[model samples]
Target: MEPKTISTARTARYISLGEPGADIQHVFFCLHGESQALADFAAQLVNFDTPERLLVLPEALSRYTMPAGPAGAPLTVASWFAADSLLPDLADLTAYLDELAAEVLAHCPAGVPVTVLGYGSGAAAACRWLAGGRTHYDRLLLYAPVFPPSIDRRATLVGLPDRPITLISTTTEAFTTEAVGAGLLQDLQDVGLSAQHRYVSEGPLTLAALGTVGK
Candidate 1:
């Protein structure tokens, strides 16, 4: 059958950590890797949590069940977007993120810094969403980032001259080679953007590993 498409309203779930009230210092917008759940991903970043910080974990719009062996239990996961409908999906993603950001920021105290962190596949999504220039953030952190060609043209537009961007990865990941991470940082810097590549230990991210980032 020939493929067809349509739009419909749906509920997208996100997790908000830390209490909202006075004394809030920072707000984080985090995106997870492919096949990752919002809650599970947030658990890994608990080290980054604090009384003055609010963590917002937004799951990708697409959900799927990963294939499993005969005895393996079914696993459900989410992705930021699908290649089959990239352009439209990207537009939709930016709109959704804009709404999410606005909703969260409405309750936040004025002058609170916002940090956008994307991991693995979510890195591309985060970059694209920020590229749209719809939301305001104080910093960009990409963990195991993979960039698309479009980001090259829009790099300077994401407040690169003023905002800091960091490419983060662990030492053990094969993709975190000096050539790959440094090349990305260099590319951003070439356009007059403040960018850097930081390496942590070969494991899940922790506050100690990410010391001084977004500071």
Candidate 2:
């Protein structure tokens, strides 16, 4: 199916692969990291052959050109929420996700299993999205996510049930260090989110790895 695009209030864009009506049983929301576009993750999902899987990539609202400081050296852009700014306000993010989710649901069917995957700050956005109860996603996949310092780990745990989420981290990546990753795992568990943390070797993220966790 031809891919469709949507414009968000943050002035960002989102891309989708597979027909909106292709019997979508599962939806994958891939939130890109800093300085990355939705297409960055879309390329990986294109490698998969699963007809039932639909991938949606939403670009961050904020745009930051590549810092190489050369004319058109290589433009790098990211979503507004991908930056390492101070602690994020959950309410603001929820509003953004609410708008984006509405656009997504407009083109897709209802009751499809939703999976949210966030890399870096995008992970934190995903967490906030889940916590806000704006969308009914079945699974949340966090890849090297950074949690907000202001986030009350205990408070966030109130509504999350056990075994509905999975956290994926890398051992070699500086962002997902063993200590930090372990802390996140413990926090999720304490909140009764039913999370499983995995330690992968340093390497590129792939659909195969994501599919493993989705299973």
Candidate 3:
């Protein structure tokens, strides 16, 4: 049988860390990795919370229950996209994120700096959204980023050259290594894109550690 595709809608949730109003000075769009809940990811970034900056955490649409511990409750988490549903999920995510960002930006004043941060598997999602979505960010920060093969490098070259892209690594990165980080930076630099690699200690990746990027 031939495959068929259809579109549908469902209610999704995202976490906003700070108020969205005239007092807001910066906006941070953070994407979480696979098997991670939005609330859990928000906690990792709670230290970055400030009165002037807004942190928007968009939860992935695809969710599943994880194997619970013998005495623990059932755990649920989300992934931005699965390998089998890559294309369709990408389309849905792009639309969802675009709408969410637009709504947040609408509440803020003009010319507020927008920063996009992606952690682990979320790095590619941030790249995909920025490549195709309508929301424009001033800088990009990837923490132990895992860039998928499906990412559009050409689009990255075109869209990201003028903007800064920082590939953040640590002494104990679980997925990405120092060599991998260096190579990714080299590739971006080869294409004349302003990319850099930075190293941090083994700890929670925070905005304070990544001082003055794209400033």
Candidate 4:
């Protein structure tokens, strides 16, 4: 099939933890990996449920249904974007993500530190958003990151002041590992970025592995 671009609207679901009227100190924007839903991922972050910290989970625009093999039932989840539609799709995503961040911050208390966390595929989208110079956050964390290798680091950190760009990965994750994820950090630093690579543990990357986040 030929490719074309069209605009459509779907319900954007954002699951939040912590009360809105409470004295929220920090707000986190967390994105899930491929074949993962916001609801499932957000559930793992129950530790963030407090008056001090607020967590927001944004659902991916695309839903993917996993094939069932020996497993009894098929699984359905979401992905940030499709690799096949990077060109125009990324442009659209850049705008949408920028708007989403702005909208979220608007309702938040002024000067609250904002952190954007993305896991795997979601990490890739997080990097893209940063590279496109869409919005600003206090911290950008990528867990078990899986992003295009050819991405330009200089372009990715454009116009942003030097800050810690953290890459959080595990030992057994398919893509970003303890060693390889460091290379990503180095590349970012080479391009005049302040980057850090951290590991939560020596096993697979899971939501439970990341406890309540802090600076």
Top TM-score model: 3
Poorest 10 consecutive residues by lDDT, candidate 3: 171-180
Number of clashing residue pairs, candidate 3: 0
Which pairs, if any, clash in model 2? Answer: 60-79, 60-80, 61-80, 62-80, 162-194, 163-194
In angstroms, give how far residue 179 of model 4 lies from its true place: 8.3
Give me the runs in candidate 4 sitting further than 4 Å from their true place.
67-74, 149-154, 157-161, 173-180, 202-215
Q: For residues 145-212, what per-residue lDDT tens digits would candidate 1 score against the true structure?
A: 76554444345234343677777876675653532576667667666777767777645577655556
Error of 1 at 17 (Å): 1.7
Per residue, candidate 2 scores C-alpha lDDT tens digits across 1-215 of 86454534445467877656647777787787767656656664565436777777777656767665555466667644423442343555667667877777667777777778777777776766676655777777778776555455556656554435667777664763533467778777676566766656555555556655434
From the highest TM-score down, the ranking of the candidates is 3, 1, 4, 2
Q: Between prediction 1 and prediction 4, which has the larger lDDT?
A: 1
Per-residue CA lDDT of model 4 for 1-215, tens digit only, reads: 98777888756667777644337788888887778866668765665566777787777777778887695567668767665776655666677777877887777788888888877777777777766745778777777776654444446656445656677766554554433576667667777777666667643334444443473
**Which run of 10 residues does model 2 get worst, by summed lDDT?**
80-89
The worst-scoring run of ten residues by lDDT in candidate 1 lies at 152-161
Per-prediction count of colliding residue pairs? 0, 6, 0, 1
lDDT value for candidate 4?
Answer: 0.68
Q: Over the full model, what C-alpha lDDT does candidate 1 score relative to the true structure?
A: 0.75
Angstrom error at residue 192, model 2: 2.1
TM-score of each: 0.84, 0.76, 0.89, 0.80
In candidate 2, which residue ranges exceed 4 Å CA deviation? 1-9, 44-49, 69-72, 79-89, 157-163, 174-180, 204-215
